[model samples]
Target chain A: MKSASFHLNLLKDTERLSSSPVRLRVMLPVVALFACIGMGLWWAILFTQLLMVRAEAQDIDEDVKAKSKAHAEAISRQDRVREMRQQLEQLTYYRNGVRAIGKPLAKLAEIMPLKVQLTDLSFAPPPLDPPPKPGQKISPFAPMTNVETQRFVIAGRTTKETPVVALMESLDSAEFERLITREKRVKSFRQDATAEKGGRRLLAFEVEYTMPERRFAK
Target chain B: MDADYTTVARHFQVNAPWKSISGTEVPSAHGQTVVRPRSNGRPPTGKLPPRLTGLHSLAWKLLIDLMVKIQLTRSKTIEIGFGGKGKSASNSKVDMTGVELFSGESRGAPAVRLVHKKDGWHILAAGFVPPPNGDLPQRWEDTPHQPVWELPRNFQSPSAAIAVNSGMSSFSQASAEAILREMSQGLGDSRPKPHTAISPRLSLKPQAKAEEPQKPAPIGRKSTLPPPGTPVSENGRRFSMRPLAEEGFHLAASLPEFQALWLGRLLPEGRRPTAASIQLAESALMASPLLHPAFAETKGNMLAIFVRRDAIYFAGYRKGEPVLWRRCPGVKGYDAMRNAIGKALGVEEELINDVLEDALVDPRPALEPFLHPVLHQLDLARAYLAGKHSMDTGKALLMGLPYGASHWCHMAEESVKMKLVPGHPFDGITLAKGVDASLAHLHLVALGAAIAAAEVET
Candidate 1:
């Protein structure tokens, strides 16, 4: 009798490899071969390009060097121009500063009453603003620095307070007040205590005012 | 081992003179009567009519001629047995009147003995025997030795008969040799294996029954299909997307075939693409690049119709790069068209002959209904291209119609003119060898994709 092995159905549920190992073996070599060829061609083309670039570079060597030198010289010249511009701005700022002070000083003389006697005059710098804290909203209109200010103090004894008041009114004119207040030009103002002077039953007072400091472009 | 069997055959010979029977005699002048059997060999003893003789002769001639013709036409010779060959036991001859048996015995006095029966002839004796000394023979073999049934010495087995019928003389010899060799080999290795039972690895087990069907998943789920313009994995093909040095540009390449398509990012990479991306622009990003060059060649904004067996893919390109891709069902894909063509062409559903042929000749009729949907798709694609890709529609729209569908060029151009500039893509780009008008038009999508892919910054 024949063996029962013939009736057996082996290989059930066994999965066949979808991608053949033989195919992979063949494909890997073929792929590698093609890849090598591709790389060879790529390198060949790259070499050719490099050679061409080198030839072009050699051809334009002097011209490039000359252009580089010219570019460096132009940069230096631009730096000099920028420095001169800064200097010119500073000079303008100084001139403006002197004018600002002179106007106020000249106004003080014009505004003073004939009965008022001047004892002393002085100047003080503008007050510094505190640095901003973290997360604090800074106002755009706020002055960035205390570089723009002209503060002055005037001391004199007047026989009557009317002249002093008149002097204060004269100084409060729109032109002077605008310069001192609108620009945050006048940071502070105060009147010192009165003092008797020269046996005229006179009252002595000291007045302090600030005008905007002069600024120039940095 | 060779096996043998024996079979017996019997032969007999007989003759009878029944044809000499006297017919009815009539009284005539001088009392003379005639017997007609002597004149005619047939029992109906009379002269045959001339017409009958002529007819018989004609029949014989025709038969002879037919036999000759048959002999000439066939490779083998035609033979009609006429009782000249050696006789065998089973061989017998019959005629219209009675049957005749030829004698087989060489020892007996040659005598023809014929038996006459009402229906047929039977062997009466081997020959007429005159008893020796006029004494009746007592023993059965004594009277006249009748031919006894003799066993045949040779009778072929079934295998031998098959071999003989097959005209292979060596088959039986080879089979005998093989059997003997196997026997010798088996005898030489008489030892039995330790494990006569079936091996565990070779044993069979009952297969598991199929499980019940699972519930359907929720809708709006992402499909396994790749996003439009993204490379798809195909059997025997590999597609990989490589980023170009330029931002928002990618090269999708398939190796071994070297089919490449260029992808322009409408949405940035790494983001999950929308359903629209997969449906509208899948072929553009994922399809082969053979479709891209026409717009580049035409150097204008254009809509390209790529006709395939199952679907017509449409893509609009600006400046030689594909902006959108859309797939419209081909006539072959429709059940109605498929059934109609199947019946008309007498072909299966898989056969796309009629659909392709009709589209080639005059597609306007069959494709008329579907063109609206295609037009809608094109409108959507064009809208997307214009709205998203910033492609200008004002430039002349060049239509890349298939080579076979050139008849529809004017109609397509006119239909598309309402929405786009319809021109030929071949007007501008210089075609390399093999990218002719026909191929460029037919596979506009693939070519466009390829051209776009090559543009990658690599």
Candidate 2:
């Protein structure tokens, strides 16, 4: 009875295998192959997309750097231009000032009497204080010297007997301050009289005076 | 019922087809028989028709043609009332007979007819109602008539021709006066006659002739100057004379002074004067009474005069040489110096003190009081740069940073030195870094102030 049952089961199994032979032959390999190919294609697409993204990022970085450099250069050039314009303006101002002083000086010369003449006419920047001695470091907190006061000096000469005192008074009247005199010397000379009678003594003097520093005080 | 049936049949015969039981016979009703209407029917060949061909009709036709050219169309239809009280009634009686006409025979028949009633004509105008499709009207050679009153020519006047030819209105009295004045001025012959009241009936021909002789008077005396003492005859005329000190003296002075007078005054305020202004002033002053050849030579060194708010400022080099002098303490702690160098070369104590202060301090504050003089010095520096001047770059930078004058002098010097090589000066000036920064700051401040003022005033 056992042998018979076993043989019967074997027969049943055989029948089952024979019933779906075509499905077994065709369906299994096709499904497996399709899944493999699909996975491979998906990986290729993802890799290509990643590479494109990286390239675009690099291009953007380069563009940003280039723009920053250009901006910096433009700023520098503008700074340079502004400096030049200022320098030009200052020069123009100075030129005009010199011309102004010259005009009045020329007028004075034209109107001056023959008895008076300027032996020396000089203009200098106001006198400056002596620079700090070498080998000594200056303290940062110390006040710097103001160079505003010592910028100009004027000196000249005139005829010996031209009433120097009266001339000084006139200058004072014209709003100039007088400086302390360093020297005043008189020299005597003998002059021939027009008639046969006599010789007369003539007096000549040399006077020197310093100019006070106030007229152009700021 | 039989009578009603006959009446219905008669009404049907008048509006629809009339036929016998065989569909071939014509129905006759009210003692009338149906007859076919003639294609080329004449209006009983009687008396002559109303004449509609004349100049007036032609004008109407022309008006219609112009309307068609401009694509104008009657947007609304005009209606006339008829058959009312006092209206005449028609005498003719008509009877209806039903008959069907051949469709082919009516293809080219007149679409409308004019029926003359006892009162007036009634027109049965007919045409095909266009399809509802929204197509635009097509261009065609022939168009409908327009009313005579709509013509543009009716509004034009005979004087329009004169306006078109002269490029001005003939009827404008102002234009006539302007023309007469121009003619008088151009001819330099006739004194301008006092204006007289124009007669309404004055002839245009005679007036035109009168205008011709007055053309030379204005032309002969082109000199804008009237005789110096001639009292101005006209109420509006006022002669202005610039002061001898300002105009005449400047004219007799040096080119530098002349240039200063012209360019300094004429320049637009708040901005620095340009090189072009200087050049222009130079040329103008050359022709002025104040012009001196010696001034031309010293122009490079002459001080610049600047007018600010209310006062004129002068900036220049001070010729400071010591001579016989006296020192007196002026009102405050300020010491006054009185020096007699020459007859007119007296040095003021205040000026000496200023020089001393400038020497002791940085030149910046000392230079402040003489703004115009500083500007003049700047001009000289520029001139020097154009010639030959040494540049100390580091010193220039230091001076320019604190004081404007030093910077200007430095740049001028730099420009001249850099010019040793062709185009080098331009490149050097452009590349300089220190002075440009300060100049930009000043300019920005000025511009901001100007903008603020403008906004406030507006």
Q: What is the C-alpha lDDT of each candidate?
A: 0.34, 0.25
lDDT of 1 by residue, B199-274 (tens): 1111112231122113322222211212212333333222323221112222222221111110111111212110
Candidate 2 lDDT, B330-424, residue by residue in tens: 11111111122111233354454344334353433333333323333343433433232222211111110122333234333453331111011
Cα lDDT of candidate 2 equals: 0.25
lDDT by residue (A73-163, candidate 2, tens digit) is 9989998797776556545544432323444454445544454434444443556546888886664422234222322232333344454
Residue B328 Cα positional deviation in candidate 2, in Å, after optimal superposition: 99
lDDT of 1 by residue, A1-218 (tens): 10000011000111111111123434558889999999999999999999999999987997888799889999999998987776676566555545444565677677779978888777665567678888987644335452666666667777667877677667777757634533223223233344433333666677776665556333
After superposition, the stretches of candidate 2 with alpha carbons farther than 4 Å from their true spots are A1-60, A92-99, A110-117, A128-162, A173-218, B1-458
Number of backbone clashes in candidate 1: 35
B194 Cα displacement, candidate 1 (Å): 42
Model 1 chain B poorest ten-residue lDDT run: B157-166
Runs with alpha carbons beyond 4 Å of true place in candidate 1 = A1-44, A56-69, A89-110, A125-146, A160-162, A178-202, A213-218, B1-169, B173-177, B180-458
- Give all TM-scores, in the order shown: 0.25, 0.17
Per-candidate DockQ versus the true complex?
0.00, 0.00
